[model samples]
Target: MDASNPGEAPETDETLPPDDPVVAPKARSIRPLVMIWRQALKYPAQVALALVALSITAAATLAIPAYFKVLIDRGFSRGGDIEGINHAVELLFGVVVVLGIGTALRFYFVSWLGERVVADIREKVQENLLRLAPGFYEENSPKEISSRMTSDTTLIEQVVGTTVSVALRNTLMAIGGTAYLFYLVPQLTMWMVLVIPAVVIPITVFGRRLRNVSRTSQDRVADIGAMVTEVLGAMKIVQAFNQESRERARFNAAVEDSFNTARRRIMIRAAMTALVIMVVFGAIVLLLWRGAVGVASGEISGGTIAAVVLTAGLVAGSFGALTEVYGDLLRGAGAASRLAELLHEEPAIAPPARPEALPVPPRGSLSFRNVSFRYPTRLESPALRDFTLEVQPGETVAIVGPSGAGKSTIFQLVERFYDPQAGTIRLDGVPLTSADPAEIRKRIAFVPQEGVLFSANARDNLRYGNWEATDDEIWEAARAANAERFLSELPDGLDTFLGENGTQLSGGQRQRVAIARALLRKAPILLLDEATSALDAESERLVQDALERLMADRTTLVIAHRLATVRAADRIVVMDEGRIVEQGSHGVLASAGGLYARLAELQFGATEAA
Candidate 1:
């Protein structure tokens, strides 16, 4: 385990910037399903195979009822010709065996196709999500994204893999069985057709209602998932404040809303089932009475009556399955709509029509020319107003200010995390908006305020910064960040498994790991937001010394609250209310008695200010 320095104080709110405004929520749309399916059809061979299997299965299922007809008319009837009866029985058994074999192969092929399509969909969604701008994550919860990739994809999977095939096969069987019944007894078939209106009309109306409720239920479930994830991720504060009851109540309420919506859906489905059974069976019994009269009058043989009965039974059973699977289709359609909305969203940050190519190895020069930006959630005032600054190649600049002064917004603009609404930012004399954001970001490294770690080993975490780094290079970067000593001390050293979000590691240790990541990148530009704030005075000194060495030939932008860190900067820029209020050497700014002087005095006291 890495040693903890409890003696080190946590950074003040003044050091860490306020959370940015919430991203503007968007209404869900239904275009993505079409696009997803269109892309999925690129694998025509798989889809065609699934369709072939489905067709064969449906044909075989319908063929089963014909075997029952043969058994009833040939094997059960004593008046039939004995030699002809035996031959018919033999043929019936042979047909059933052939169909049973086809059923097994069809099931296997369709199921395999479902799995493949789901895997393909998830891979495409994840890759597109990764390509999205940082602004995408700022507005959406990780849970919301995960739900689309997981739960929504599962819905599509069921639809493609099972429900769709079942619906189609059952539909074919229903149609084919109905046709066969007409051939067996044309008079009884008319009654079945007459009852169709009674069943079809109610189901069509109620099924529409069920589909809407399904959509509401899915959206509510997603809300519950997202809320739980956000709160559970911050469980430390949730536990500290004794807010478990509150969170439980909140989650229960969301879940209850989903339950209620789903209940409404279930009620509609139940009603539809009752209507279908009542209509179809009621017609069957009425038609059987007519058949009984015909038999009494000797209009049809006992064997013919039995054959018609068997076909009628097949028709009713297949129709019932079709009705139920139709409800699943409605629900699946609702899920498809939700997933489609995410896939269709227009990314807030779009690349230029003809993006300018960035230099292979970017120079360290960075500049902001009258840049101004307002977050999508807040349009009242810009986060950074007419921000103008320039850093020479290989110069280190520290940005310091009071709360809400737009200190971190500068780094956001520099990294093109958000493009300015007005004016421009440039790297190596090329406008950031014109250059590819991906290309520009490749030249920069960021150490965020909170050290975000994936669930992985220490070595794996360090390697994220530079995937091609050799083991020696990774260890060297760890040493430069002052993290190698603690990493080496762990029981498993570099191979030691870290818990989710690196929860197993101390805050300072996580911060050191983040530093090691930045060092590994070895980009021409480094951006740090309270990189050493998690460490004790002693550890801070050690890590700070290492950071200074790492920053030697890179263009560095640091957001600092402590006067000590500002003093090490080659130049200091003071900002207030989204505007640059002061820019000079720390000593010069302190002597100027401007915003920087007051801020330094507020933190260091009047004696230190002197």
Candidate 2:
């Protein structure tokens, strides 16, 4: 990002640190000033108002030092009249009042700009994340996303809210003061001009190191956050394993890395600070010494020396401020670049320019026509290869397979979570890829393993499947899932709060609640992925009865690890290594003594074999 100073060149990629040395060795190219300006330009009227206020504030500040020049030289010089001093003092007081008001207004407007810009950047980044492909999250963590929205935005807020205005005010003041110095002593102003580069050089050059350190520090902080989130989310597992000390040690190391990087940044900033202060003030002091000698030799009046000194001091202070602003620009530039990468990433899955709409009421006839799929990261092995299947509407098909036999892959493809690399999946004879993914998902209800639940009321959790469901409808769904009995036993019943991940409820209870949510969806198609796995024998019997009833008139896909679950299924498709090994009714498949028969006899024993 180009900074306020046009003369100082911007840092290139070679100056920046890489995100990861092995995977993403190349540094990212992102211009933060572009984001800032884009946001600033969004509210042009507000920006205009703030800039006007800033201009008035800068003018007021420049007037103060000029007022002091008149006070010390013309008004209070030796042998000057006391009345002149009194008049000068009144003028100075008036300047102070104007400055006080200007500074206050400047603070209000600049801070407002900062807050608005931060909010816009955060909203944009979030929207981008939502549209991003699943692959993006696979590489980055939720912690990294959180950090970008928070700490990175805070850095941007500092740049927008504080640094920009400070730089502008000081810049104007410095220019005005220098002009005044030239009017008082043209020869002396030339020496002051020579000192400007001395201050600018260190801030520009050393600022590159600061930016690199800031990026590293932020990465370390994000690592710590990721570790904390992972451990906390699985606190039960962590405690069971007695890994508290291990987790703490990892977190401590992450924090120490962050601290070390921050220290490096601080050292560079401090050095830059010391350099600016010495170079600016030192040049002024040298000028002052020359001015005093010139005054003694009758070359200029005491008042002239005094006025020149006052303007030079104001200019010097402005230069010092510029140095600090330079550092912020560099640091903020890195932050902006990282944010832009996330915001600009295009999702691999996107709605077609003109997508075919689903039937208002879908008839769930599903077919896989020579469909093949392989995750992009694992392109060497196909998860599903030329898989072909067809089910008439309202048919219940059970899928039985060992692990990694493309069972889950089928569910994902059916829901349009991923597109098949070859051929197509169709719904009601229309290609699934051509249909809107949202439309396809809306017609399907998925009950995954382990029963995912949010920290919300029981009623609210069920209502998620059908947001507009009435209270009575929610109860009906719960009753169908056999959840109403336990729910009614609770003190608050439907209004009872389910703690995080439904931790307050037993495993069976959580599973029942999940089944209730699926029942509420009333989707034409149902997918059960070991939906009864968490339930105990009694609960499973009851819930299985409910699930059979739930699947009566809908097209259903069942992935069962247990043999008992598939006994009532219309047909069982046995799969091995991503291919269908056998397919037939359960009794027939068992009688045939194939893969299904082997699995069935393993669970049901010789009873099934006989």
Candidate 3:
């Protein structure tokens, strides 16, 4: 086992009945059936319709035995009227029609109800997932969460739409058929019902085993799904590294693991079905022998005997079918339990019950005082310690530091992605904790290093910065970011579809689009984190020119490792090991022979500070 990830259990063909958190978490009881069924009740009209149709179908099925009894005893016996025989045959055909129509109606309503319920569940799960904070994902892989959304939800859809409906219809048939058996031949039915205990005993025992195994089986399938998602999402990485054979081996292992678990579940369910059929039919054969003796003595009519035998078959058949349904229900229960766990995950960050409003016309000032923080996933290492800095309105302050010096940490703190373990952070003189995260984020425009763009059109991608932006405004921002020329070159221009993650564009082009997005935000503060790090000289010069104009009236914090990029900052702050070691202009720092001077020496050589 890899000890680093306690949450990710090793994948194996043999797993315990229920996994941690998926079905039973921290000793908390999970009743997925009850929870899922209660949700099914949300659509009252559909539930009622399904119930009515189910009842009609059951009644029609029960009436078929009555028709058989009438045809034999009243119409086919000695001295029987021909007219009576014809009427009995017609009545039998009528009952057949009723059964078919009722069955169809029952199926329609039940399937419709199942589909509607599952759709609502999917929507709710996704909506809840959106609200959870990053810490939740630190422990849970996106692959697993996505598996729950697709594989698990598909299982639930089957359970809700098909399994539940079949189980209900069979339940009604079994009960109604058993009662009709008694009315047909009390003497034979008395002896026949005795085998009920025999059938019930094995069902109870095997069902427990199947339910446990079903949970494990569903978990294994989810593993396969998670693996597929992970490998496919990084297909380029896998091919580049020439790990295709290794990945295929891993994928095959997961698939076989899932299949093995399912095999066990299927075996258990099959055993249960076999035991039920053997006992139920064995009892019926004995009942038939007794009925034959009773008929020899004229104790029961032939018609009654026939109906009793048919009804007994119905009872046994319904119970046998239920064994299969039991497995599906258990699988569904496990899925619902997993979804419920996700829904219950509490986010580390949430809006206050009544958040204080931000100051009108946001003043572009930011401050951090004696702040300390550690990322949740890397709690052993501090990302920031005793960090203190202040940026005045309309000032461009550039932070220069080596890797892991907490340059990006400041941006995260300002964005309220994580709260500091110690000290306070404020914007516009209001503590960040006192205001809603949305309000704080709205006042600062952020352009991340990677320049993330969605699989969407150019217009939609740019409009993401300001959803309500007009066409003219979008074009205006694109022009300012030096992206309008390339955008117009595309066949469909703004409406052109950018492939996944904007794969159709070059790195420099993607960066320009990201800048355009931030420019369109029109916020009071701008955050640029190595935005020009990956650009070529030509792209850098052009982007820097556009950036100069964008930063003219806004407070800007720039993180740069290329000393030349930030040489013109109003003030440069040098940091190392999460603490600011020097603060000054380019000339002042170079002449003092400090850490900044040494860094400049390494990048540009000894004799020149330029």
Candidate 4:
């Protein structure tokens, strides 16, 4: 592939960074663009108006040459009258006016259709992404997916809004101008039409290369986007380690790689455009020479020859423009196909056609029986093996374990974020698989280790758990979590905007806000996964106090690495590898002298011994 710029050299694959994922040949047929077109058809009124406007624009364009012919032969000929010439000029001006109006209408309708279609695609893609299982995300990066939603959708917008409109209008002019040329002089038109194959065959070949390069360019662009998202997400870490210079160098390399690929695609398209234009105008030149010969022999009039030239020029320009439009459509088709792939991805877990409803009065009981599972990305090692546990209604059961001991996996399974490879999980005696995921989630509240909060006001964040909660309910929940004081102290009290991920608040404040969110949820079951592990002692004590209040009259599951936090639970379950090694009160487990005893020694440090 040549570079997009005439003087630049083509970039080689060897220049790509080692970490870049090799782009594979995954684009399907043109069916994806067809799918997008189907969406455009949904707005029949806009499509119809656009088509009508397009016809007017094309017809007006084709009519100009006829009026020019009349102006030349009947108005400007030696024997022509001034009155006739003036009438012809008036007709020409009228055509220009009609053409101007037609062009504007076409632009308006075509642009509207493009925006509407792209908007629909973006909305639907986002809706689907939210429901896709975590396993899908594990296999794909979030940044790449986001790039598709933005960059790829923008490409589709260009096609629907501009490329398709230009192609359709040009097609009509090309065919119409050619027919008009025949009416003026068949002999010249015949020779011009014969030149079509020479240009088209070359376009067909180079266009394939351009399509391949375009897809690669898109992938490289997505790579750059993914890299930027990752780096920005961990900006604090990068700055803390003073890795800014290294990160900048890496990012520059990715950007350059993307530029090289894009340049190659551009060059291929440019070459095709130039080739088509040369062939088209060369045919016109040949026809002009023939027409001049006819006029020299007195067989053709000057006005007639002029009309033929005008129509031939239109035909040539239209054909040349088609080559460029072809390139855009191909690129857009590739983008549409990528988006289609995402849209068609079915979630790994889907609710049954008629999902069974949990018992009306919510019970917090949770039970896992003989469950075995491994993460999709980590298939070699089971995260949980033959794990069985039961937390009766209103009981607080704490799971204590080292990293990778299946502690958090218990919370994930309960949330139905994943399904175990074997055995069953049930809530309120109903098999989890039998109930809808949304319904099951409504009865449970989850607080992850890293408290999740969006960029919103304090009120909005608290209301996220219960969108319909009144202001008083929100205040009550905040007080319960000990977040009321800080929240009220914010610039706008409950209305203060939290930065991304609640960056405006301290670690403890975020935790308290998270607890308040869970508290507001008012669910019968609560999932706490290391919620207070990162907080300072004061914050931890406050958060723990909130947790205890939250646990009352609710079935709670806590995943804690610090055994001290779980010491007061009704029961403590110790897990190692993927199975439970011990289960009993902290005292019983300490006396049993197993994994729990050693962990207690490391954390609490043999309280009696001390």
lDDT top scorer: 4
Question: TM-score of model 3 relative to the true fold?
Answer: 0.92
TM-score of each: 0.91, 0.90, 0.92, 0.94
Order of models, best TM-score first: 4, 3, 1, 2
Candidate 1: which stretches are off by over 4 Å? 1-40, 75-80
Q: What lDDT does candidate 2 reach at residue 337?
A: 67
Error of 3 at 26 (Å): 8.8
Model 2 over residues 1-610: C-alpha lDDT tens digits? 1111212222343323444221122222224566687888888877887788788877777676666666667655668767877887898788788778877888888899899998998998899788766655654566656766787789889989999888888898888888887787788778877888887777767776776666666666656666677888888898999998998898888788778877987898889989989988988888898889989998977777877776777788888888778777767766776676566667767778888887767888899888889976678988897888888888889998888899988998888778988988998877887887778888999999889999998888989889999999998988888888888887798888989988889988898899999888999999999899999998889889888987888999999999788888987888887788899888788898788888888878969543
Give the lowest summed-lDDT range of ten residues in model 2.
1-10
Best by TM-score: 4
Task: Give the TM-score (vs. native) of candidate 4.
Answer: 0.94
lDDT tens digits, residue span 1-610, model 1:
0001111111221211233111112212222245345645877876787677667766666666565666566665668567766776677677677667766766776677667777876776677666667776765656766765677778778877788778777777778878877887887788788888887887777776776676666666667767778898889999999999999998898788778877888888898998898888889888788888888998876666776676677678877777787787766666665544454455566789899987657788998989888986577977988889999989999998998899898888888878899988889989988988878888999999878898999889998989999989989988888888889998898899988989889999999999899899989999999898888787789889988987898999999977778697999988889999989897888889888889878888877875
Instruction: List model 3 lDDT by residue over 395-502, tens digit each.
Output: 999998889999998998899888999989999998888889888989989998888999999999999999999999999998887788999999899999999889
Worst 10-residue lDDT window for candidate 3 reads 1-10
> Model 2 reaches what TM-score against the true structure?
0.90
Clash numbers, per candidate: 0, 0, 0, 0
Clashes of 3: 0
As a whole number from 0 to 100, the lDDT of residue 358 in candidate 3 is 80
